[model samples]
Target: MTKKFYTVSARYWSTLDSVEIVQDGEKSAKFNASVITAPAEYSFHCQLVGTDDLYPAKLIPNDDEAEKWDVLISSFQIQGFNIENNQFSYASDCTSFFTPGIWMGLVTSIILLWILTYGIHMIMQLTTNSRFDDPKGPALSVPQTE
Candidate 1:
């Protein structure tokens, strides 16, 4: 049952990075990936590190078929994380993943707001405050007339 899916136009960051593998512009996989295992040829084992849905699927190969199947299963793993460096370098391709303009717009808006706020803060500091006259005391405190 080959259901056609359009992948997002993205490429892997590198051999070390992870990416979202969506089906037909959605993160939802078409196949029921109910199994997981290591490659049969080698003693290499695979542990499913992540999934979008809580429907977790983790497996280990006990037989040859299960091991061969692991190759197919590996393809389903989305979102690679670097445990060593503690960083996230996201994958590029995903022309199939949903291109919701709203999501993109929201991200853009947040960035713009940050830039604007930062500019305002700098401008206010430059105009109102000096090294000697900077307000170090509480604003609500009444001056004790000595």
Candidate 2:
């Protein structure tokens, strides 16, 4: 089977406020549920490009009745901070706090590599002058000798 690629994949986190079951005149929904976190949740929902079988219909908590509703603590991601009910925070530059030496070592190694490459190039030019020709340029005037 071939795997399809998604152009966008995003994660959302929200605490559901409530769930409810609404009964019409005759028909009823067994697996009916509404999702509620906060107003920010909708903005994240708006970014979703595709849909499962049950979408385009907003899932909201049934704020009227209480007995007919069931809350499922499934690990589904939602959009925005549910800070009215929970806390999710983010901060930048965490790597500097944890591993400063790793970044510094990477920079030092890159500089050392450039110096070694230049030295090797000069050594090769001096050793392989079998044709006995002195190329004219500022490079030749550098006077590199043992």
Candidate 3:
């Protein structure tokens, strides 16, 4: 399997601080922040912390993977907050096989469908005393009795 890395960043302002400013209809302060998250080996955990303006206060790379870093900075403005100067780093495992249980289920479903279609064909043949023929082929002839 191949692994891919992605970094997510955003700029925003929070209303937590300066309640008076918010009460007076003043815009919240803007700041820039980023977080780096990677898939855990034999475990999956992503921590996101919320601050007055930035979310996921800090980003820490997983120790097992290389120190490849990807930086993503938010360009759009959200409410009264502005984000800038953000960096992100992460890693993922790209090699893994589908679980046996899922594969078995899929195979079982296909087999069941084949069996059902075959059973229907057999029933039609028995009832009509004729082989199931394709509509695209020549039509069958009916015997005439005196």
Q: Top model by lDDT, which number?
A: 2
> How high is the lDDT of residue 12 in model 3?
21
Q: Rank the candidates by lDDT, best first.
A: 2, 1, 3
Candidate 2: tens digits of C-alpha lDDT, residues 49-126: 112333432344333343244333333344444334464333111112435688789889999999999999988877
- How do the residues 77-122 of candidate 3 rate in per-residue lDDT, one tens digit apiece? 2222221344222322222356578899999999999999999999
Candidate 1: tens digits of C-alpha lDDT, residues 1-146: 11122355232221221222354674332223333222221122233323333223433333433433322344333323232345323333313344578789989999999999999999887763223433776555435672
> Candidate 1 regions off by >4 Å?
1-99, 128-146
| TM-score of candidate 2 to 2 decimals | 0.26
The RMSD of every model to the true structure, in order and in angstroms, is 17.0, 16.0, 17.5
Instruction: Assess the local accuracy of residue 15 in candidate 3 as a C-alpha lDDT between 0 and 100.
Output: 25
lDDT of each: 0.38, 0.40, 0.36
Q: In model 3, where do residues sit more than 4 Å from their true spots? A: 1-91, 94-97, 128-146
Clash pairs detected, candidate 2: 12-78, 13-78
| Winner on TM-score (2 vs 3) | 2
